[model samples]
Target chain A: MKEFNLIQRYFTPASLAPDTLLGVGDDAAIIQPPAHQHLAVCVDTLVAGVHFPKDTHPRDIGHKALAVNLSDLAAMAATPRWATLALTLPEHDDTWLTAFADGFHTLAREHGVDLIGGDTTRGPLTITVQVMGHVPPDQALRRDGARPGDHILVTSTLGDAALALAQWDHPNPAPTLRARLTRPTPRIAAGHILRGRAHAGIDISDGLVQDLGHVLKASGMGATLQAGALPLSEAFRHAMGDGTNWQYPLAGGDDYELLFTLGEADVEPIREQLAGQGCPATVIGRIEAEPGLRVLGPDGAPLTLEQGGYSHFGN
Target chain B: MKEFNLIQRYFTPASLAPDTLLGVGDDAAIIQPPAHQHLAVCVDTLVAGVHFPKDTHPRDIGHKALAVNLSDLAAMAATPRWATLALTLPEHDDTWLTAFADGFHTLAREHGVDLIGGDTTRGPLTITVQVMGHVPPDQALRRDGARPGDHILVTSTLGDAALALAQWDHPNPAPTLRARLTRPTPRIAAGHILRGRAHAGIDISDGLVQDLGHVLKASGMGATLQAGALPLSEAFRHAMGDGTNWQYPLAGGDDYELLFTLGEADVEPIREQLAGQGCPATVIGRIEAEPGLRVLGPDGAPLTLEQGGYSHFGN
Candidate 1:
């Protein structure tokens, strides 16, 4: 199939939002921005082998590609409106395209995002998704608002993705663990609830310690994360017997959970709000007046990790 | 260097536009869209070897990546605003990054575009740029407005870039020709002038014939072009004595010029306005009531080209 036909057949779905003025076949998609709102924009790229295993499902690749970008918008407490994809594939595969589009459109419909525009080219497999959304200017969550004595919280359990990756090549890998790595849930509802409640926010893609480090650095504050307080899923705890695999949650990457800071007085209320929405929030750390990160072990002593987090290039 | 540090050092230039509330460092950039305007968004991807030769300069790659996306925005008659880049590189090279950033930022500054936010990852060389701009809702140019009697116009020359590619492997290619292929100028100014006057518009990145075919298909009109009226640059004419190579202009891709349609009455005024801005336009054809494209040779008879245009997959 030709480039235009492929895009039309696979990516162009009926518009879900009314704000898209000119979608898909145009040189550019014209979108009507809602009045009195700030537009949140983010782009993320996923390479075939670098970001996921070569044997990964095409549907999963498509899902993860959009999921990661939406996670960024979720970090900013933005409601997704539109997304443009730039997909480079080795060649046109009908089955692959169908499955990929199914996965992408499924999540996009759930979030009410329109696939407005995209480009398809011939090359090694690579997917770049740019998601645009809107958030109230006054209520947009940022990473520079953390204050001393604020409680740092996260949505859902962490490190399940990393643990899944570790067992990806195993003969009998758990399907639930694999699902966590391949299809991450963007915490859009959690982000919406934390908009006015959370002082600072970031999505934990590069593990808790490193992602939290970004929040601390941006806010110019320190943080103390309780090792025992880091929520682990039953799957993770059962797989990691003896319950001492702190590195996965601390320094492992690819967790699409939201990490935010709430004022001490607002923590319980925000947590209850998130729980009511089916996504529970856990207070794993607290912001401090100092300017460095420290993790308290189960016994309440300082703990150091062998490695920080996943960086594209080694530091 | 780590991914974050590389982005900070190279891609994170000081913000130029005041509308950017948050840029570069955040999970997502926050921008305040101007009221009473429709946002135009588009994305384009460039892969090494597929889009450009492997030996192409890093600076050229960077310039072309942004230029192509800007051309799409230009086609929509949108004033350029913010852009997000998703760059996947094979490895870190300091010199390449410096030159690439210089080329990218230079063009971005010229167009008053801010590098709002992006993601950097390690993989085969690929660059995906998503650009967002704005235009008055009523004045936004589209590909579906051409009338039966409208005149088809194109900005600047068409085949220079294609001719440059033809001579790319020569011992000493012309610098001007090489520049045309490497850094074709985007017709943002022409697009601005065509906003309220043009019937339909598109960028000639996939050759004039193919790109104009899109306009015809969308507008539900046919077109007849005078092959002799196709504008050729002086260098192009000088290089080909007794020129009969119509394929270069008709079927060659990578010409980042605007191909638009204007009513008979608006033609001269729009041409003068564009020429006043230092970009000249040519009347190549006229829209017809028929439903197919026809090219008349200098002898006034119909001409048939060997190929239609470049497609990602062979037709």
Candidate 2:
């Protein structure tokens, strides 16, 4: 199919948000955002070999591309509204585009995100998604708000996505773990519940340690993690086979979980609230008066990690 | 520098919009858009070889990437406010980045646009810019409002960029034409002026004939162009060094001028208004009750176009 036809057939139909004053088909889309709300915007890019392994399924690629961007909204405690996609493809394959559109629209519809506007081109496979959301004034979660002595917490399990990646070359990886890796859920609802509760929040796209380090740097604070307290799922254990491999979850990237910090006093009630929303929360550590992150072993001894988290550039 | 460090040094500094409640450092940028206005959003991508010749100056690449997106806002008669840059590079090149950022910020500062948020990755070189703008409610120019008796107009001149491209292999191309090809200006001022004066508007990115067809299709109208009325620039004429080479302007593209349709009686005043803004407008045609675009030659006979315009798919 031609580029214009492909978009008209697959994308134009899905851009039906009532607040979208103007959707696809124009040079730019016009949106009438609700009054008294600030707009939150972000953009993310995924390269075939660099971000994901080559030859990944088109559906998975589409899902993960938008999923990672939506995760940013979840981190900001904003409600996702609209997304624009820029896709560069090596070739035009109807089957690939059909499945990719299915994957993208499925996730977008769930979050009420409308396909507002975008551009398509001929090049190496790369997907860039810019998502816009709305957050009530003074209600957005920020990385700069982590106070010393605050309790650090995370939503859902960690390390499963990383472990699933490790099993990529295996003959048969656990379905649950693989889903965690390729179809990682964005914790939007958890974000909403934690909006007024959490002091700071960040999505763990680049591992828990590295991403949390951002919150620490932004807040000018430190943190101490209880390694045993990190949530590990049964699927992760099955994928790893034997001993504890905290490194995979702690330092491995693409987890897409929420790593947040809250006041010491507000933790229990917020935990209950999130659990009621089907997103259980776990207390991992506490923000410290010092200026670096440290993880304590089960015996309460300091555990040294080879690296904090993944970096596109070697640290 | 690492990806994070590169962004901090080069990108974070460009985010200075006071209305940008949150800028580059956060999970996503937050902006308190002025109340009572609609948000205009647009995205565009530039691939290394496909969008431009390989090894084009990084500054020109950056300028065009943002310029193209800004052009979309111009077409919509919107005031650009913020932009997110998603850059993919094969490797870290500090000098290239410095030049690119200089070029990007030069235009951004001119338009009061801030670089809010983005992602960087290692991959084939690509730059995707998503621009957000604002237009007052009921004041946006749309493509669907052209009338049968409306006059079609284009800002500045057409075909210079396309003509410059035709001279790409020439040893001594006109510097003026070269600049038009490399740095086509977005007629934002013209668009703003036409917000209320024009019935419909669009940018001439995809050749005049084809792009105007979109306006016609959207407005459910047809048009007739007096071939002698097509605006031709002296630089384009100097580049071509021939008589009546109308194809370059009529079917060639990368012209970021605002092509708008207006009521016949309103054309002269609007043209005078645009001229006062230093963007002279030209009346090129008129909307008709017919259902297809027709161009009349000096001989008063309809001319046949070999092709309507450039398409990603071969015609």
Candidate 3:
């Protein structure tokens, strides 16, 4: 398809607000936030062979790139409003572009975010998405606000993505396990719920232990995760026997769930509200005065893992 | 240099502003914009084989990737404040990473932009940068504001980068020509000068004519270009005989210069101010009440040539 044709067919959806002075057809997009809202911006990139397996579906690739960035907005306790996509492709295959846009637009619209601006270039199969969300300046949650007495909570089960990845290399894994790796849902609503209440927050891209380590480092505090309180999906348990699954839960990447800290007094009400919305909430840890992350195993001693979570360069 | 070590050494420069609440080392950077200013954001990616040659210098790749995005910010007349880099490499090579960061940091620091947050992944070599700048809500330039009879102006000489690129496959034409392709000077100062004066603008990434095509299409107007007025760098002229250089001037990509439109009344004063600042400004076209771009060759007939721009899917 031609460039303008590709834009009209896959972009320029009504989900975008008219407040956007300029969107996809220019050098860059122009947007103005509502009077009381501050813009929360972040970018993430996914390469063909690096972020996902080479054989992964194009639709999933599109979903995950935007999903990972939405996860960033979630960590900030912001409401995602708009996004710009920078896509570098080997060639313009109409079918691939369509499926990719389908995946991206469906999720963007569902989250009430619009595709505002982007650039398409001829290059390798790489997708970079910059997401912008709106938050009242005072209510935007960040990783620097955790206090020693705060309660650390995580949304939904962990390790399913990592476990699913392990089974991904297998020729045939169960359908459920495959979908977990292919299309993990980002907890958007849970983030909105925690916006005003969370003291600090972050999305788990590089496993719970490593990602939480970032929050601890930023907040200048420590954390102790309760091993028994960790939530695991059935798919996670099936891939790694009960005990082994804990390692993946703590170190496996690509969960896209929010790990946030809230004031101890606010947990009960927040948890009830989240439960009302049919989202999972678990108090897995607590913030501490010190500055290192530790995990207490089921036996109540520090759990030692062979390696830390996935690093870009690999541990 | 390992990923973390490289980040700490090269990427973690002190922020220029006190309001920079967060700089690198976190999942995302945080900053409080001045109360009166709005944020302008843009992202651009350069792949090794597609955007540049496979064996292109890492330093040049780093410079161009950031320069291109900065050019976008410049088009919007935004003062760049922060950037996030996402690099995907095939392996963990110390030399390459060090040089890449060195090139990136040098330009970033010069522009007062800090590397706030980023992700490093293992894959084919690709660099994606998302840059954010500050623009007063009422002062940001856009591509849709050009009115009929506006004078279209461009900064510096055009077609040098394209000529330099053409020389790439052959022999190095000259040091001046080579530098044009290898090191692009984003029109930051010129953009700042034209901020409130220009009615609309866009950086010329896809050749002067094609990019201006975007401005015209968006403004719902037409343009008439003076072929003789196309600015030619000394190196471009040396490479192209005066008559033939028109092709390069009109169609070469990678120039990263600002092509903007100003009201007829503001032209003389803006030009005088820019001249005082030691920047060259050229008025080569005029926005018309009609609705298509027309180029008048030396003979004053409509000029039509093959499309001279790059598109993601267009060959």
Candidate 4:
């Protein structure tokens, strides 16, 4: 599709918060900072050969880029307001640009986010999306808020994306497993519901076990997760056949779901509220005043594991 | 020059606006959006093998990436508040990361922009920077404000970047031309100075002749320029040997400067004030009542050219 055609078909007529004075199709985006809120902005980059395989579909690449940034916003409990997309394409293949723009615009609209402004240039195929969200003046959620007695809960499942990537081309892998790898959904609505309820939160992009370690470091607390209570999709169970692939679920990356902590009194009520929306929540662990994380089996014994999640610069 | 060392040495100590609550070295940077000012945001991406050559120094790559976005802030005449840098690298080379951070932090500090938040991922050598600038509630500079008789003027010289890139490997082109290509400074101070004084402005990233086309299209005005008056550095003259590489000057892509239009009455006074700061100002064209651009020769004849400037997707 042509550039203007793609924009009109996928990006126009969206409902942004009252503060977003102007949306997409402009030289720059203009936002009226809310009366008592501060804007939180972040950017994420996904390169063709490094972030994803060269042949990864354009739509998936587009979705994951925005999904990751939205995940950052979720960690802060910030309500996303606007986004700017900076896309670098090797060539202007109509089909690819059309699919990419469709995926990006659809996600933005679903989250009530506006596509304000960005730049497009010729180069290796890479996508960078910058997201802006709003948080109440003094109440922005942070990784530093977990307390000694906080309940550590993860929304949805963990390690599904990692499992999917491993079996992507494996013979006879079920369709459900492949979907986990290709179309992992970002929990935007759940994130919105989570605000004000969670003390500290973060989206699990890099395996649940590894990313939570960051939370532990930042909050100065340790965590204990009951392995049996760890959410696992059916696909993950099937892919793990003899359970040898279990490490994939604990250390894989690219699951854009939120991992958060809440006060003990707030857990059951929040779970009930989430169930009302068809997304029953799970409490997998608890934060201790200690300084490290330990995963436990049903018998309360430590579950020994070798690998952690993927690290960008870690060897 | 390890990545950690580079960040600590250069980026950590940079000055920041009073509202920058936390800067760099975190999962995400936090900022205090000024009480009454709105935020203007934009993102731009540059990729090796697309935006620049793969062999280009990491330092220059870092500089250009941030410089491009600073130009966007200049377009709105917004005071840059904070920036997020998302870099995708192929490996964890300490020296490369250090050089890149040095360039990024230096330019950011010079413009009073703070590095608030960002993500680092393993991928192609790609850089995406999202910059946020503050404007009073209703006072952002825009592209849609040129009047019928506003005079159009460009800051610094044009085409120098395009020329520089063309001769990037030349043993030694003129010093000015090489600097323009390797490091075309963004008009950060000039942009703030022009706020409330100019009607509309935009940074010249594409090319003088083409980028100005955006302003013309947005403002619904035409422009006329005296051929000999297009800003030309002595380096530009020396690089093109016979001055025939005008295409590099007119269509080159790396110069991060500003192209703005102001009221005819406001021109002389603004120029005089800028001159006091040692920044030479030039008025090369005027906003006309008609609908397209024209470059005039010495005898008042239209100076026609084979091509206008560089186009991202254009062949």
Candidate 5:
């Protein structure tokens, strides 16, 4: 098939959102940003074998590519509006393209984010997603907003992706854990709720400790995370046996959940509200004036970690 | 070195444009788009060996990655503003990073597009650039706007890049021709000038024949081309041996010049004005109500070519 023919066959059927004035066929997509709102833009790249295992399904790759970008928007309290995908494939495989498009179309429909314009090239498998979103003036959640004494919280359960990763070699693994690893949800709605309410935010694509460190560093503050309070899922606990596997929740990455902060006076109400919206937010730490991440054990002592996060370059 | 540290050391030095509310390091970059202007977004990916030669310089790779995206914006008559780069490298090489960033920074500075947010990863070389620009309502140039009897025009010269490609294996080559091949200038000024004047527009990434096909398909029109009227550079003629190498201008790709259509009345004056702006427009064809491209040879007879243009998956 021709390049245009391939794109039209696989990527054209997905419905476009109203904000996209002109879609894929145009040189550039024209997007109507809402009045008085700023456009929040971010790009994320996932390389096969490096970012995901080579055996990973094409549909999961498609879902994760856009999800990671949506996670970025959620971290900024921006409502995803449109996306452009630069997809580099090994070759034109009809079966893979169909499954990939299906995965992409499903999540995009749920978020109402249109795939506007992008390019497809022949190469080793790599997917890059550039997501655009809108945030009302002064309502965006920023990393620098976290102040000393602010309470840090995370949405949903932690370490499920890592738990699934640890069980990758197992012939039969828990389906819940595998789903978390392959198709983690981006908490865009929670991000919308936290706007003007959450002091700082970041998505936990990296480890909770590492990502929170980003929030701390950007805010000129530090964080003291409570190990006992980490919302590690029951599936993760059962999968890892009775032994404490704090490392999974603390240092393992790939959980696309939201890690944010709220002030003392604002924490409870917003937490309840987000919980009502199906995202259970658990307060796990407090921001401090000095810089550094201090993860406390259940007995309130500083815990030692063999790894901080999944560093792309470092072992 | 850590991935974050590498990014900070190399990719973070460039000064941001004032419109960038948040530049790299944040979860997402927040840009304050100009009021009443719609965001024009486009993404382009350059994979090593596919988009450019595997032996191509890292600097050229960097330049072309972003240049292609800028070309898309130029086709839309949008003012280039901000860009996010998703860079996937096989490994962290400091020398290559410095050269790549230098090339990227130079073009980005020239275009006044700030590097806002993106991710770097470990993988095969692939540079995906997503560019966002601003276009005033109803003023954005579109491919679907061509009308019957509209005069088709192209900016600058064509076939130089293709000629250069043909001579890639020559022992010695012209420096200027090589630059044309490796670094085609995006015709942003031409797009800007053509706004409200040109009826339809497209960038010559996929050659005159194929890209014009896009315009005709979108506009529900056809085109009749004058093969001899094609603005093939004199340098191209001198470089080629005596042969009917008209396919260089007719079917070769990656020229990065603007191909557009304007009403017969609106053509001349705008052509003169664009010439003053350093982009000389040449009318090579005319839009017809019928569908399909017909190229007339210098002998005033219809010309037939085996290939229309470069298709990644086709001959």
Candidate 6:
């Protein structure tokens, strides 16, 4: 297969946005950004064996590659408008390329994101996606805006993806847990709802404690997380019946849920708004003037954690 | 080294663009696109052993990674602005990373481009760069804009990089030819000069014939090239004394020169304009109403090319 033929066959999906002046088959994609909006740009790379199991499905790889980048836009309260993919593969497999394109385009169409441009090369399996979106300049959620006494909230649940990884060698892993690992949802609509409301925001891709610590450090504040208030999915709870695997939620990575901060008065309203969208928002911590992260157990005593988070280089 | 520490220490160069509202350390980098301009977005991936030799210098790899994407922008006649990188490496080597960053930042600083956001992962070495620039919506040089009888032109010379690659294992490759291979300049200034003047444009990354074929196909036209008119650098001419290696310029890849078409009347003015900027432009072909590309030898006889261009998957 020629590089041009491969791209035209698998990657050049029709544009969905009117602002895309030119899409694929050009030197670069030309886009007209809507006036009064700031462009939010992000890039993420997922390497085989490091980010996913080597045997992971090509469809899942495609889905997760875009999902993680969209999660970043969600944290910024940006509406994803376009994405460019740089895909590296060891060999040309027709079935794999078809499935990968299907997975990528399925999510892209769902989010109204145009597959504007991309580069496909031959190498070890590595997928890099750069997503571009827009948000009102003043309303863009940032990590440096958290204030003292603000409430730290999270969308949906965590630990399912981590649990899926831990049980990968099991005879039968739960489909719900495995799905969380392969197809984590980006809280884009929830991000839009949080715009102009949340003081600070970040996507929990690197565990709750580690990602929240970033917010605290960036905003020059501290946080007290209530371990009892941490949200867990039904499947997660059932899988870990004794609740001994708290580290999966607290320190394990790859959740893709939004962790955000807001004032106490707006919590109920924001929660209700998110509930209307079929997503639940839970208050698990509060920002403090002191400058360190603390986790409180159900008995109201500080609990120390053994691990910080998943670091790419730490291992 | 932790991922965050690695990013902070090596990749987080301070912003040089005021419009970069929020840079690295955020969920996404935020930038205000100047009003009345369309954004040009492009991405390119370079794999070790595929795009460059396994032993290529880290600095040249970094420079070329960004340069190739900038060449895409140049072909679109866009002014470079911001870039996001997604790098995959097998491990952390401080010396390699520092040299790579120096190379990337050197070109970036020279072009007034800001490093806005990026991701670093552990894998076989691969670099993907996404560059965003601004071009007026009406003035972008696109491939589909050529007309019959438009004179085809190219900036600087070609075949030097191809020659250098052929002599890579030699004990002493010509320094000029090696630099052309390792540090091919993007015709950004020449692109600016071609905007609103050139009817169709493309960057010659995948050989002159293949890339020019793109322009012809997009414009629904053809071209006739004169073999004697193809520009050759002093290094290239001296290296190939008898000029038997015509395939090096016609079918060899990695030249990064701008290939464009303009009216015959505007040819001299455009060539003079480019020459004033220290880049020479040569008229090598003319667009034709007929629908196939043809190359003429020195005796006015047609010449056949043995190869098309570089293809990632063809091998």
C-alpha TM-scores of all predictions: 0.98, 0.97, 0.89, 0.91, 0.97, 0.98
* Local accuracy of candidate 2 as per-residue lDDT tens digits, A191-238: 998887788999998888888888999999999999989888987766
The DockQ value obtained for model 2 is 0.62
* Model 3 ranges with Cα > 4 A deviation: A1-9, A144-151, A169-172, A219-223, A238-244, A262-264, A286-293, A300-302, B1-9, B36-38, B137-139, B145-148, B169-172, B241-243, B299-304
Native A-B contact fraction in model 1: 0.82
B268-300, model 5: which lDDT tens digit per residue?
A: 899999999988999998999999989999999
Error of 4 at A205 (Å): 0.9
Instruction: Write candidate 3's Cα lDDT for A79-184 as tens digits.
Output: 7887777777877788888888888888888888878766666667888787877777677777788899799888888878877777777877767766767777
Model 5 chain B scores worst on lDDT over the 10 consecutive residues at B1-10
How would you encode candidate 2's per-residue C-alpha lDDT over B1-315 as one tens digit per residue?
013656767877544867988888778889998899999999988888777777678888878988998999999999999999988888888899998888888888888898888888878889999999999998888888999989999999888888888778789978898798788798898889988779999888878998899899999999999888877887766656657677878888888888999897898899899999999989988999889999988678998877788776452
Candidate 3 lDDT over residue span B1-315, tens digit each = 012434655567755566566566544455665665766777777777767778778888778878888888888888888787777778877787777777787899889887777766677777778887778776777888889989999888888877877778775467787787778887778888988889999888778888888888778999999988888877677667645657788887887888889887888898888778776889998999899889998788888878757776654
Residues A193-303, candidate 1: write the lDDT tens digits. Answer: 988878999998888888899889999999899999998888888899885788898988898999999888898888889999999989998899999998999999999
DockQ, model 1, C-alpha based: 0.66
lDDT of 3: 0.78
lDDT of 6 at B179: 95
- Which candidate order results from sorting by TM-score in descending order? 1, 6, 2, 5, 4, 3
Alpha carbon lDDT of residue B267, candidate 6?
96
lDDT agreement with native, every candidate: 0.89, 0.85, 0.78, 0.72, 0.85, 0.89
What digit string (tens of lDDT, one per residue) describes model 1 on residues B259-298? 9998899999999999999999999999998999999988
Q: By DockQ, is 2 or 5 better? A: 5
Q: What is the C-alpha RMSD of each candidate to the true structure, in Å?
A: 1.6, 1.9, 3.4, 3.4, 2.0, 1.8
After the best TM-score superposition of candidate 4, give how far the Cα of residue B61 lies from its true spot, in angstroms. Answer: 2.4
TM-score of chain A of 5: 0.96
Residue range A211-288, candidate 4, lDDT tens digits: 788778778889888887888887677667765455765667777777889999999988887778776678998999
Off by over 4 Å in 1: A1-3, B1-3
At residue A289, candidate 2 shows an lDDT of 79
Error of 6 at A101 (Å): 0.7
Q: Supply the DockQ value of model 5.
A: 0.63
Interface RMSD of every predicted model, in angstroms = 2.9, 3.3, 4.3, 4.8, 3.4, 3.1
Give lDDT tens digits, candidate 4, residues B196-293: 88887877776777777777887898989776777788767665576455565555656667777889788999888767766667888888879999
